[model samples]
Target: MRLRKVMLVFKKDWLEIKRNHEVILPMIIIPLILSIGFPLVFIVGITMVPESASSMEDLENMIRNLPEHERNALSQMTPLQASIYLFTLYFLAPLFLIIPVMVSSVIAADSFAGEKERKTIEALLATPISDSELLLGKVMVSFVPSFMITVISFIAYSILVNILSFTMLGRFLFPNLLWIMLIFCLSPAMAFASICLTVIISAKVKGFREAQQISGMLLLPIIALMLGQIAGIIMLGPVIIGVLTLSIILIDYAVLSLSVRAFKREEILQKLI
Candidate 1:
């Protein structure tokens, strides 16, 4: 209920997070790779490969394997062009989702577990703040940084891709409606879901590494979605993305509600006994 107390907790966490290189490095490095490095490589590689090197038969055979809808979607583009769009744009969307999820998970995994590891949980719990305030503060600490990183990464990615491919595509081709929706609508929910699950696991686990390792399991579904997209089985249209966003929102709500219910200072205190 008290904003001041929440802000104090948030500020404390922020300071600690900045001092932790293990957390800070991955947060920076992964986004750079996902948003900048990979796209640069894919776009540059596609443009460098001679179109003459690939046969029409080869292109057609590859396109034939795609579903009818997918085939129609890329019907106008050459194989190399299609590969460029697919790799730099469509395929990277789900993979980029991993950035926020990982960022949130790493931080949330440190929420209570790190406190326990440092023998600081007792002091934190002894502070004059309600459990809800404590939880909210921790949630914000994880969610805000992760969300900002996701947004910044997406913007950087959009600029990198559009500028890099402008000559080839003839216009700004990055940030399609689906991607915009994915970033604005689905990403927060996904981050919240990861953080909530990680916090819950952190409270139950004994060490930061264990909590982080357990929370890493949240990426399995994301990896599966990435694979499905690669296989052309999952097309991320507005309708599909809307459904995905809704599903993630629901899951986030469920996990957060359960986490709050399960979060008892007594329980955590007993674990330390």
Candidate 2:
């Protein structure tokens, strides 16, 4: 339970993460695409398309279902302007969640499972760290980088969105309360949950790739959220984001607690044998 021992494990894993191209590539590429590529395409496409295009119908319908205040705000803009504003700020919001979950899952998948793959599990378990110290260290390894990546992605996305939309909207269009809550609150919770789940799966599985594949399923809920907002079935306003944040935090606590109880150095060593 000592912080010094926990950090020793954290430092060791951080070093491994830096050298693993499989882990580093996605961590870098995915955020770039989500922050830069996606927004650029959406903003340019929306700006070019005429208001009378049939594709505007779906966006219009989605906006109509928004709350009165939000609907009123969008109503002030031309269809093109509204489309760019809404899509960038809201419709694509859930995609940001993917960065954290994916980053954490990839690293957590490598935690113990990668040790087994590389034949290093015995050496790691032989260290003097207690089970709780080891578990917390692994959790921090995943959570720290994932959360940092999520924040940086959010900043990049926010800047790009403001720059892209500035000509049409005549104002900066990001860093609003909803997004603030999303990155600072819900994002960490989701990332922690993904890390814990992936850690558990990583320990139980036989290899890093297997653990990663299973952890990838964690994206289903985030994907569903994106679709729900687009379909007008749900909206990620302040209240909703707050609720989801609390729910995910509770889930994270429960999963982490379970991981601590169930994780055993000898059990993992036995699996390696």
Task: Please report the candidate that would top lDDT against the real structure.
Answer: 2
Error (Å) of candidate 2 at residue 177 is 0.5
Q: Write the per-residue lDDT of candidate 2 for residues 24-81, one digit (tens) a residue.
A: 9998888888878887786666567665323446676577667798888876877677
**Candidate 2 Cα deviation (angstroms), residue 232:** 0.7
RMSD of each: 2.8, 1.6
Taking all chains together, each candidate's TM-score versus the true structure is 0.90, 0.95
Off by over 4 Å in 1: 51-73
The positional error of residue 86 in candidate 1, measured at the CA in angstroms, is 1.7
Candidate 2 residue 75 Cα shift, in angstroms, is 1.0
All candidates' lDDT scores?
A: 0.82, 0.86
TM-score of 1: 0.90
